[model samples]
Structure formats: structure tokens, C-alpha cells
Target: MTLSAQTKVGPAGLISDLQSLGLRLEDNEVGVTGRRGGAGPSDHKAVSLAGRTVMIPIATVSACESPFVASRPDANGISEIRRNGVVVSHIEFPRQPRFYDLQTTEGIPYSQIATLHSSDVLATTLLQSCIRYGNRNTSCQFCAIGQSLSAGKTILRKTPEQLAEVAKAAVELDNVKHMVMTTGTPNLTDRGAALLCESAEAVKAVVDLPIQGQCEPPDDDIWFERMKAAGIASLGMHLEAITPEVRARIMPGKAGVVLERYMDAFDAAVAVFGRGQVSTYILAGLGDTPDVILSVSEQLITKGVYPFVVPFVPITGTPLENHPAPTPAFMAQILPQLGAMLKKANLLSHDMKAGCAKCGACSALASYEV
Candidate 1:
């Protein structure tokens, strides 16, 4: 039943290890119900697995003072545990970047636009306010993109020049290797892809770092080509949920873009960024059945898109805070299927060149398979 032996284990073993960490399996999804002591959303839960904690929704673990739990034998905020009584340690959480304290000459907060994750890559949402957030009925249920803006923690927009300045400082001072530029949907003809292109061009003006740009697919396929010409090395067009019903329920605003548009975007991006350079995020435990997710992943792979499947760890302040995280068992079942698909497609994470999936910090699926 030992799950982490550098070799894949059965789904049941993954389930057992998660249950040992106080997780529950409901409707074939693994999750837990508890409060981390926050202001809003009292019923939020932490997504823990194999004794390690993933994302705890903002409502669940919002404040820095919130009471959260770490499993025994903690390793720098991550937990470690044994399946079949063989213990394995978890990876360490990367430290917060030092560049956050610095500000641009215009007195703009640098951290407002971008922040570091997993301790190395510099990630930014150039446009903090999403038009979708204005419509309560249509916004992505799991997004807190505008919540930070409402809290006055970030700015409404960031210019390419400002982003370029920050990238320079982050690379020179923090040794950042890669950069991720994502945006809130702007009501524009290019669907925010053009803005990402501008930012990528500016950043490339300062450094030759690997850059990944994510957005809803542009209305025209040609934007993918433009993005590549602008110095963007990779592309991520996230299909958060594969099922139509799930998409409507969890991401009404984003769902309007339709799966066909995302598929088209991915295909065009694959042609521009190349196969392994194009990816999409498929969130687990969002009401999509494993069969459904697997089927969608297969189609995506056939079209040359890497399905970056992540557990649905609800964010606080969002509608899904009360929602649960997918169990290790669920991830284990899906990871092998995804791995086999990738193997057949001749796509590998190591070939991605750079990005979140390439970093392999958010989920253990990449390490478990590739």
C-alpha cells in the first residue's frame, strides 16, 4: 500500500494515506471540512494529502493568523506520512521573494502586480480587475482575483514597462528563472492576449528568461502567432473544468468562452509554441467524473496540449471555499491515465522548457509520472 516509492501505486493506497491525514472520500472525491479561523466563509477546508497541505481556500485560511494544521514530521510547511507504513517526506514550500518589498519609481507597489510562487518563478496578474467579477452571476466561482483588488492589496492595472522593471529586479536580485504573466479578462477584441504580448515584449527587452503567458484564447487564432513573435515561449489556456455542467456551475463567465474556443486556441498555440510548450489546467474535484476528465485529457493530448491536472483546492472569499479538495486517491487514479496519455503523445513535462507544470511544485502528479 506504500504509494510514494518512486514507482506508481494503486488508487486505494493513495486513498488510505489521505484518510490517515483526516481526509474523507465523498462521491469519489477526497476532501476535508474544517475552519482555519478566518473572517468570511466559516466552513472552508484545507486540501491535505499524504500528510501534506495543498491550497486552503482564502476563506478557510485567509488571515496570516488563522489556525491551520500540519501533519506530523513537517518539512517547512509541508507534511509527510507513510502509506503501508513506509514514510516519505514532502517537498519544502519555497520562501517568499525579497523583491516584494521594493517599489517602482512611480511609487507603485511591485508586489501588487506580481509575486513569487514556489520561491523562484515571478508570477503576475497584469490586470488585477476582471470584467467578469462585476457580474456576480458570471464570475469564476473559485477566483479571488478581484478580492485582492477590493482589499487594496493590488492595483487595477499594470503597464508593460512597469512589469519589465520588476522582472529585471527579480532576475538580478532574486535569481528568478521563469516568468508567468496572466490577466483578468479585459473587454477587448484580442481577449487580453494582446496585452500579454505587450508585457512579454517589454520583459524580453530586459531579460532572456523563459516566459509563459496565459489568457482566455483570443477571438482570432492569429494572436497566438503574435504572442510567440513577441517573445513568449509558452502558452496556457486553462479549461478549469472539462464537463459543461461543471463549467456552468463553477465558472459561468469563463464558460461563455466555450470549450471549442479553448481547443482551437490550444491547437494554434501548439503550432506556435510547439507541442510540449502548450498546456491547459484541468482542475479535479470540480464535479467532473474521472471518466470525463480522462476523456477530455485524451482529446487534449491528441491535439498536442499538455493537460496540467491539479486538485481543486478552493480559495477563500470565493463561492467554492466551502467546497472540498480532491483526495490523493482521485489524483492517483488520474495521474497514471494522464501519464500514459503523455507517453503515447510523446509529450513530457521535462520537454515543457518552463512553466508551473515544469516546476512540478503545485502537484505531485508530474513527479509521480514523468
Candidate 2:
């Protein structure tokens, strides 16, 4: 149950509550369009709460049962956030980006090439298809990478030229501050690092926005230097679950790469990207306890890697669609201690050049940094 009105929960607690418990929308609150399904953080909408933009789950199964209901926006586009019919705070959704309405010189819609993440970040999937996604035995059960491609919302492959075109427009038209390019693991040793390099290089040539490249650790460490040289400002190599048992059970194909290899990769990447610039994503509520997550996060921070812990919101059509998300209390147990570790290491998310941790929309961990 949420705290009573007599309790004074600050913005951080409110953000965590909104993220973990999700939010319901009133019938008239449909002016803003929420992303239904996509590659990263699917079934969510970007909302501004207490002046901080965050990705809040709205279309998930958990949201259907949430006590937090958002009223329709007033004339000024502000909505009241009520928990159990009592007003707690206010929120505003980001307007549809101007770049989303434009088309490339060749007439392809810019949105198919790239989309807005948070309020001002441009994000794209370099390759929509992954080698393991087609096979259930090897697939990450929570992934929706193929769903967007299958529904014709995005293209299978985004060429360097197309990405550059959309990126430049996103910067000029929508004031996009940075770009994030993640790809499905291809059938190669570089594991899509090569594609990210090509795409980042192209976008940098056309626009000045910082870029973050995310992919599996390449077979060779040299790729990190190449990525930094190609104008990629930061890197993300996600270890979605820390424990081997959970990793194997949740993402069998990814677990094959092993945590030891990831440790070595983080060390090498940190050398190039510099400390806090290298980060990872650890999904909470995947059966790994907060203690285990914090233990691994400490190791990553010691290696100069930022471990971005996020609550797992089950996406539709995936194997775990009906699975429950972590409760707000669960996140409460993790973020405070993790934030203290980050503070001690001086690995502030604001110090990151460009990445998920920097944007910090999908998780409230950043709010606990204070």
C-alpha cells in the first residue's frame, strides 16, 4: 500500500512509486501518445515529474492495477497525479517531437530511422533483427526488439546515411541533446560493434550531439578504442542479471558470453571511455536479490563502471508478460545504497557524456544520488 497523505514522501520516493507501481490514465487523458512496444523500455511514456523527466510504465499489466491514476491534462498540459483518488503531485508529458514529422531526402519517414527517448534524446536500433531473437531457446524472454520491426514501426536495418539524416534533423528541429544507438547482436565476433562505429561516425559527421553506443563486448578489446575514435562518447554493456543462475534462466543466449568476459570488457572500456562513461543495465525483480545486485554493482563501480539498476516491467507478447514488476519497496532497498556507492566513487550520472545512465529516464536511481 502507498503511504497515507500524512506521510511526507519527497520527489525521489514519488518517482520510484510511479515507476515501480506504474500509473493509470483517466479516460480523457489520451492526447499524448505513449509508445506501445519497442526495443528498450517498452510499454512506457516519458513524463516530467517535479521537473525531472522519467520513463513511466503505463501500458504494462502492473499499470492496470496501480492506485496512481493521472487525470486529464488541463489547458496548460498539466495532469494531476492521484494515489487512491487523492492528489499527490502533477505531471506533464513531452510533446511529440518535431523530427518525428519529417522525412529523409529519399522520402523515408524520419521516425522509422530514429525516435525520441526521454524528452530530448535521439535513439535508434542499428539493426532491428537479432540472430537469437527468432529462436525461443536462445532469446532474451523480455525482449521486444522484433515486435517493432514486425509491426512495421521501424526498419530491419538503419543505414549510416539514414541515421545521420535523422540525427541531424533531431538536433536542429527538436533540440535533441544526445543520441543512443543500440543494435541486435549480429552473427559476428564484434557483435554489432562494427555497425555502431559506422553509425556513430556518420551521425557525428553531420551533427555535434554526443553519442552512446551499446552492444555486447567485442571479442577483442581494440574495438573500444575504435568506438571512442569513431566519435562515440560513451558505451553500455548490459548485464541484465548479476547472478549466473538468473542470467542463464532469463537470458540463456546472452549468458553464454559469461560474467568474467564482461568484467574484462568493462575494465578495457573504462580505460577508453573514462570511469563513469562506461555503464551497464541490471534489471531488478528478475529473481536476483538486492544484496546480490549491490555486491555486483560494487565490483562494477570499482572497475569504473556505472551499474544502472532498473525495475523490470514485463512487456506484452514476451514470455514474462504476466510476470510482476518489482514493488516500490524493493527499489527502495537498492537505490539508496547504490547511490551512496556511486557518490563515494564520484561516478555521478550527470558526469556521463551520453548514455542511459546520463538520460536516467527509465530509472529513479539517479534521484537517490543526493
Candidate 3:
């Protein structure tokens, strides 16, 4: 069922609102298995409506159950999104990727190496185990990286050859456009930069896919040039929370890196990868006000960095799992401001060679792009 773009509320606003509130998945048999790399436990599933595809959170502790969203198989595969018994819109879920089925010659499951993200991006946590994950004093309060590994969903480490093979197959089978490779911080200084370089080289040898390598800032700034030379078209150095209070309270282990160090790394990365290609994830509602978040975003934009501010999603099993997600109004207040700033800087997500902001599925800020 096609929806009329002109609704009581604008279509983009509706998407931003739904993503903020989170959709209630009722009897939806088709969905992706929840991954443990990031802040949230809610499954990253593709939701299509209003001529666009957005990845929304579902089947988590924080998901809303009141305004139920169900896929009616009996109704010709249409998804009805309801608000108090009235159908507001019909949505569709994307089918699972083909690459999940095949394995490498050595019997490693392809999915263990990497998984499909949104519709066209392949993302993987290159090293599933983080040095800070087990140490409570050091761990990021919102991280669940070790949870998936404990459940046997992914391998401990992916070899460069294995990652290369998986990348090639995902591209050939699903027509994947870009790939994102993120890793748990191996050590305070290692930060997976060396591993990412090897992985990118192997993947590029077999296929010509644009790749983004995400890691904490490395000790040496020269790693940025090495990453770019190794076929990493984009780089993501995420500061999940901005303020020092929030950082020290939430991600104690990572906070030791200091905010100033990350800014320096951003400048070096932008110089190597160019402006829009360097991005960071500043998660809102992690003890920062809308104004506070916007202020940091402004500073980041001035340094030729793309501040991809995302709303915080509480994941089950993490310390902050019970923490409240940011309200729709707060998101509504901040996203447009950030989007406008991005527009003024001419740092469009569309111009990003490859990365999360370019994918624009996890956050609704892209919906507000002018």
C-alpha cells in the first residue's frame, strides 16, 4: 500500500517521530538478529515508508508497545502502523540478505564475519571482544559488544582473508554498495587501526567496494593516512557522548582518551580523508541537553568534521539499559539545527564516500536534510 506523502504531519517528521518513539513490532516474523557492537539492543531492521527506507529499533526493552505496528501476512504483506486502533500508515520490511547463508571454504559462516546493514551497506564488528568490555570500571556503560560473542552469534576475531571473502560475496549476492568495519578497542593505543588496514587491503584486492573503518582515535595520528592508503574511503571516530561528565560517568575506560585527543585525530583524519568523509557519533540524551549537543556539533562542523548526532537508544543488559531514550521533542529540536549546520558547511551525507552518516538508516537527521 502506497502512502500519500501529504499527511497531517509531514512524512519526514513522522519518520523522525517513529524512530524516536520506536515502533512496536507485533508478530513480525522477518527481522535481523540484534548485533552487540553498539549502544542499543533493539534489532536494526529496515522499515520502508514515504518513499524512503529507515532502520528503526524494534523488539527491545525500550520499544513502545502502545502504538502497535504489525505486518499482516494475511493482508498481502502490508504492515499497519496503528495509534490507538486507527491505522496511520502502512509500512514494509526489507527481506533478509542472501550473504548470511553462505560460508567460507574453511567453514566459517559468512555472517560471523560480516552482516548486511540497512539495504545496501555491509557492517561488521571486526574484533568482537573489547579490552574494556569486561572491566566494569573501564567499560562503556551502554556497550553490549561481549553479549553477542557470549551467545555465539559472532567469532572472536575475523581474519583479513575471511573478511575479504565475505565482502566479495555480500557485494556479488546482494548488490551491497558500501561496507562499515568497526572494532572494539583492542587496547588504549592499538584501537584496531592496524587490523582495519589489513582488512581493507584484503577486501579491496578482491572487490571494488567503498569501505569505512571505525575505531577510537589511535595514539599516532599518522594511522589516518595509512587507513586512507589502504582503501578506507571514510573514517568514523565516535565520541558517543560529548560532555566530560557524561563521558566519565558512562564510558569510564574510553574517557581516559580525553576529548581534546579525539578532536586532534578528527583534524588529521579530515585532512587525509577530506571534510565530509570524517564523521563521529555524538549520542544525544546521554546526559547532554539539546543546546549542549548542538554546541559540540557546531564546533565539530567548523573543523571539517561531520557530526552525526544520534538519539540514545537504551540496550538491554547494559548498565544504562534502563535509561530513558531521548524524547521526540528533544530530537525534533536538535536534528534540524544540526542538519541546517551541515547544509551550511556543504557537508551533505550524500557526499560522504562511505559510512554511517552516508547510510543514514540509524538516525532520522538525514530526513531533515534540506
Q: For candidate 1, lDDT tens digit of each residue in 156-265?
A: 78889999989998998899888888888887468789899999999999888899888888888889999999999988888989878999999987898889878877
Candidate 3 stretches greater than 4 Å from native: 1-6, 28-42, 64-68, 74-76
Give the better candidate number (1 or 2) by lDDT. Answer: 2
lDDT of 3 by residue, 1-370 (tens): 4544444667777777676667776664544334444422245457677767677766456675535465553435557777566677777767778999999888878977888777799888888888988888999998888877777778889999898889999999999999999998887775899989999999999999999999999999989999999999999999989889999999998999899999999999989999789999988888988998899889999998888888787777788877887877888889988888988889889999898999887787887778
Pairwise lDDT winner, candidates 2 and 3: 2
Among these predictions, the greatest TM-score belongs to 2
| Full ranking by TM-score | 2, 3, 1
Best by lDDT: 2
Q: Model 1 segments beyond 4 Å from truth?
A: 1-93
Can you write out model 2's per-residue Cα lDDT over 1-370, one digit (the tens) per residue? 1222222588888888888989999874377667766678789989888778899998889998999999888887788889998989888877899988988777888999999999888999999988889988999989989988888888899999999989988889999998899999996599999999999999999889899999999999999999999999999999998788998999989889999999999999999999889999999999999999999999999999999999999998899999899998999899999999999888899999998999999998898887
Give the alpha-carbon lDDT of every model: 0.67, 0.90, 0.81
